[model samples]
Target: MHAFTVIRTYLRLGLLNFVQYRADFFLGVVNAAIQFAIQLLAISIVFNQTDSLKGWSRADLIVLVGVHAIVSGILGTVFSPSIGAFLESIRLGTFDFLLTKPVDAQLLASVQSVAPQSLTSLLAGIVIIVYGLQTGSGFPGFGSVVIFVGLLIAGLMMVYSFMMVLASLAFWFVKLDNIMNIFNTMFGNAGTWPITIFPGWLRVTLTFIIPIAFAVTIPAQALIGSLTLANALLTAALAVLFVAASRWFWLFAVKHYTGASA
Candidate 1:
């Protein structure tokens, strides 16, 4: 069967799976609302103490929150579900079944899982972003919006690559689930503050080492008209490098799994 046929079949199955669990779908909305409220409360507290943090006003920070929420939602909806299943398959030895399939192993593993509930968080993020722009009166022009969106797409690609790298680690160290937990911990904390608030070394780590800064901060910076040309170019370069590295790592891991002694 063609790849497109496989994708359509899986997409239908995924949608059916979510429809069967409709209650969780509604709860997703409530959870997203609460999450937004918590973020806004934190922002309010910070603004009460200081008008700005690292040159970002409260509205700017709200945009940051939106960017974080949107990216988090996408991760939860797509990357987390697929990668979690990939890890589980490895542990249970079902990964061999996936490898035997005619379809692309990565594509099969990636599209097999879907969490429809995560759309709630995505919607809430857009709401927060719109509200921020309205209050701040800093609506971006057409070119700026296009740049912001491009940065966002680049950010998502960087994150997907990062997750793939982590998932590939499962082939070597099955016990590295703990490392994934740590990644999640860091990701959760990412939404709390702008990357600029971190120390210089930490900022460098976020930007280059992990690429989380690209996922959350750069898009927010674009929205606020603060993204620098150099930084944007650097983000694009990092995204390309990550994609190449992740593909290499996935292929290497597959070779190792096939009993080729690395």
Candidate 2:
């Protein structure tokens, strides 16, 4: 209850701040439009050259792209902004103030800032998904949609856990922003495409080592009604493992964190 109140308060304040910058909303919409165009064009060019990339058809690829956009929007709108602030606060020794508060530092840091502008990407993603489904297999059955939503939630949790793990590294590393750079690059380049095209080793790396598989591609599989039993089980198991590991690692990092006073 206390945590929910804090979150609600921060969210309200963030929205107030966001409304103060009306231009940002337009800019975000423009950027989302441009991104949607480029991504659609790239998919078009690929399908024009070949009817299918691996086993994924044109509509399948479009669904994948939509899932990518939705995931990207979520990361940008929520996780990335807070993680950035947490890292910066750690670097500037302002994390001391957070530790002094009664709330859990992790929760506080996770919701520290909000970027409402990135909701444009989520809207764009939804539009693309509707376009894809309508033009292809049509909307999924209720069970599939339910499963897809579950997978998407699990996938987002994994990504959040991974980002939290990375942010916690600020307790030790100096040039830590580069880690986010690598993640963004890989997500844009690799995650937007189906991971099945990659070689076996790279596929394993993306699935377990990096999380692109569970985050973007696997949920896509559910949406397209091709989610395998093995993949579904793996997604659930990995989500749990990632959350637990991230939590433990965060606690360890916080335990060892040296504040300005220390």
Candidate 3:
């Protein structure tokens, strides 16, 4: 089958599987609500003690929080779960079936799992973003809007590539599961504050090494009309680089997998 056909089939099976557990849907809604409330309360507490945070006013920070929530929702919904399943497939040898298929391996891994529960987070994030836009001025005109969307797309791609690289490591180290827990912790914190709040060293790490800033902070900056031309260009360039690097790494990992299994 073609890649598109496989993707459609995978998505259908994922949806059906999620539908089998109906109660979990409501549970997911509750989880998203609690998460949103906690994030908003944290923002409120921070703003109460100070008028601004790291050059961001109350409204600006709220918008940042909203953007963070949206991004968090997206990551939890698709990138997180899909990659987790991919790693598991590798460990269990199910990945061999994927390698033998006609479609792209990464594409197959990515579209294989779609948790229905993540929809709750996605909806919550959209609501928060919309609320932030309504309250904050300077919503950005046409050019800025285009740039914001581009940055968001690039940001998502960068994050997925990074996660794929980590998942590919499972081919060599099955016990790497615990390490991904560390990634989850880092991901949770990345959306809580602007990268500017980090120390110089940490900021550099976030920007160039892990590139968390590209995933969350840079996109938030774009929304607030603060992203510089340099940052914008850098994000685009990094997105391209990460994609190529991830493909190369996955191919290398695939060779390792084949050799190990053989």
Q: Write the residue-wise lDDT of candidate 2 on 1-262 in tens digits.
A: 3999888887788788889997998999999999888888998999889988998989988999999999999888878898999989988889999998999988999888889899889888888888888887788889988888899989999989998998899998845899888988988889888999999999989888789989889888888887998999889998999999999999999999988666
Candidate 1's displacement at residue 249, Å, is 0.6
For candidate 3, write residues 160-184 as lDDT tens digits: 8888898889888876788888877
Candidate 1 local lDDT, 1-262, one digit each (tens): 7888886787678678889998988999998888889889999998999999999899998988888889888888877888899988888778888887988897787777878789788888888898888888568999988988898889888988888888998888875678888887898787557888999998888888788889888888888888999989988888899889989988888888843222
TM-score of each: 0.94, 0.97, 0.92
What TM-score would candidate 2 get against the native?
A: 0.97
What are the per-model numbers of colliding residue pairs? 0, 0, 0
Best by lDDT: 2
- In candidate 2, position 134 carries an lDDT of 84
| Every candidate's lDDT | 0.85, 0.89, 0.79
lDDT-superior candidate, 2 or 3: 2
The TM-score leader among the candidates is 2
* Better by TM-score, candidate 2 or 1: 2
